[model samples]
Target: MTRFALTVEYDGRPFMGWQRQRHGPSVQQAIEEAAFAVTGEVATVHAAGRTDAGVHGLAMRAHLDVAKPFAAFRLMEALNARLRPAPVAILACNEVADDWHARFSCVGRSYEYRIINRRAPLTFERGLAWHVARPLDAEAMHVAAQRLVGLHDFTTFRSAHCQSASPVKTLDRLAVVRDGERVLVRTAARSFLHHQVRSMVGCLAQVGLGRWSADDVTAALEARDRQRLALNAPPDGLFFVAASY
Candidate 1:
């Protein structure tokens, strides 16, 4: 058997999430079925992280083991051919060591949240970005985001459904910046709790709107209570940008 590493990209709008689901379609299901069609083997695909419904992935890292004999390039071509019509695509593929793992070997992950700060209705960016009609002070948002950039108890930003054992995590970086009418929130960490990035972006949005002060964010973090969370941004704007080994 050979293990293959895959770099996948997908539009999250059409599927439930990265993982397979009984109720709806998923990115994993699509790719797995395509692989089965190509290799006639029941292979399990493991990803670096799982994204929620409506959350997209630009370059998700995944690995799967197959018993079929095929060159790395040929397998990638066959998988892509069979994955036709699905938004999921295998951007790159290569063989990896048997001990290499997509999830366990990952050391860092990053996500990007896009916000369209405009009153006009979205045309091309619909379902791809969050539209905030009210003007936002990106600079204020940036300053407030810095408060979440270190080790802290992040229970306030964690989802009630989060299965993580601990709410305490080290946030390596969190930055808010503006380019024209676009407000972007970029964050990185070893791993994140459920809804952690979206939750942080929501609170920072409040700061941009002048609804909350930086002290409010500090207080929320110190509270270590989920109820203290200001808001949870929708999944439309969230994108799994990359995973590092």
Candidate 2:
């Protein structure tokens, strides 16, 4: 079998998430179906990250093993052709070593959350971003975000259903930026607990709204209790921005 790496993009509005589910469509199942159409074989593909329902991915990476010889670029075109209208696309396909696993080889992962602070329901951004009616304090949010940029046990930000063995993670970066009425939060880590990014965003939003102080965020992190964390942000605003190998 020839091992290959695939760069994928998808609008997470239509499916049940990145992984396959018995009850609904998924990015994995979509890609797998396309792979079967092209290679006449069902091969399990692995992704760099498994996004939750209603979450999008801009540069998700995957690995595929095919027994038949096929050109990388050609495979990309064929797969996209078959996956049309499903809100999923195979961005690129390139040869890789058999030992190179997409999820395991990843060195870092980046996520971005977008929110429209002064939105009138965000008609254009429906299902794409979070819409908030009140303006946010961007300066305070940025300054407060610095407190989370280090190694810490993030149990408070983790979901109870997280499959990761531990909640300890090193937050390499957390940046808050503003673009007119839209606010974006970008974060990176070596690995993350499930729902960690959204959970952090929820807490930061409190700070932005002047409800939660920076000390409150710190206390929540130190508490290591899920109940102490802020309400989990909606998944519509979250996007898997990139994966660094």
Candidate 3:
């Protein structure tokens, strides 16, 4: 069997998420089906990260094993041809050692959350970004984000349904920046609890809107209680930006 590493990109608007689901279509299902069609065998695609519904992926690394022999470029081209009409695409593919794993071998992951601070209805960016009617203080948001940039128990930011064994995680970076009307929140970590980035973005937004202060953010972190969480940003704005092996 030959193992192939695939760099995938997708628009999250149409599917249920990365994992194969019993109830709806998924990126995994699309790629797996495409792989089966190309290789004439049942194929399972494993990803570096599993995004939530409506969360996009810019470059999610995945891997699959195939029994049929084919050049890396040919395999990638065949998969893309079979994945037509679907939002998912294989940006790059290459042969790799059989022991390499998309998820287990990943060393870091990053995400970006976008917020359009405007009153007017979204025209082109509808469902692609978070629309906040109020003007946001991006600098304040950045300052507040610093509190979350280290190892800590992040219970307040984790989802109740999170399957991770621990609430503690080392947040490598978290920054908020504004470009005209756009507010961007970028974060990186080795791994994250479910909803951690969204939850952090929501609280940072509260800080941006003057609803919370930097001290409040620090207090919330110290509280480490989920109930203290102000909000969980919608998945619409979140994107799995990249994964580092």
Q: What is the TM-score of each candidate against the true structure?
A: 0.99, 0.98, 0.99
How many Å off is the CA of 3 in candidate 2?
Answer: 1.0
Q: What TM-score does candidate 1 get on C-alpha atoms?
A: 0.99
lDDT of 1: 0.95
Query: Which stretches of model 1 miss by more than 4 angstroms?
Result: none
Tell me each candidate's RMSD, in Å, in order.
0.7, 0.8, 0.7
Q: Answer with 1 or 2, whichever has the higher lDDT.
A: 1
Candidate 1 local Cα displacement, residue 162, angstroms: 0.9
The 10-residue segment of model 1 with minimum total lDDT is: 68-77
lDDT, each prediction:
0.95, 0.92, 0.95
Residues 1-245, candidate 3: write the lDDT tens digits: 99999999999999899999999999999999998899999988999999988899999999999998889999999999999999888999999999999999999999999999999988887878999999899999999999999999999999999999999999999999999889999999999999999999999999999999999999998999999999999998999999998
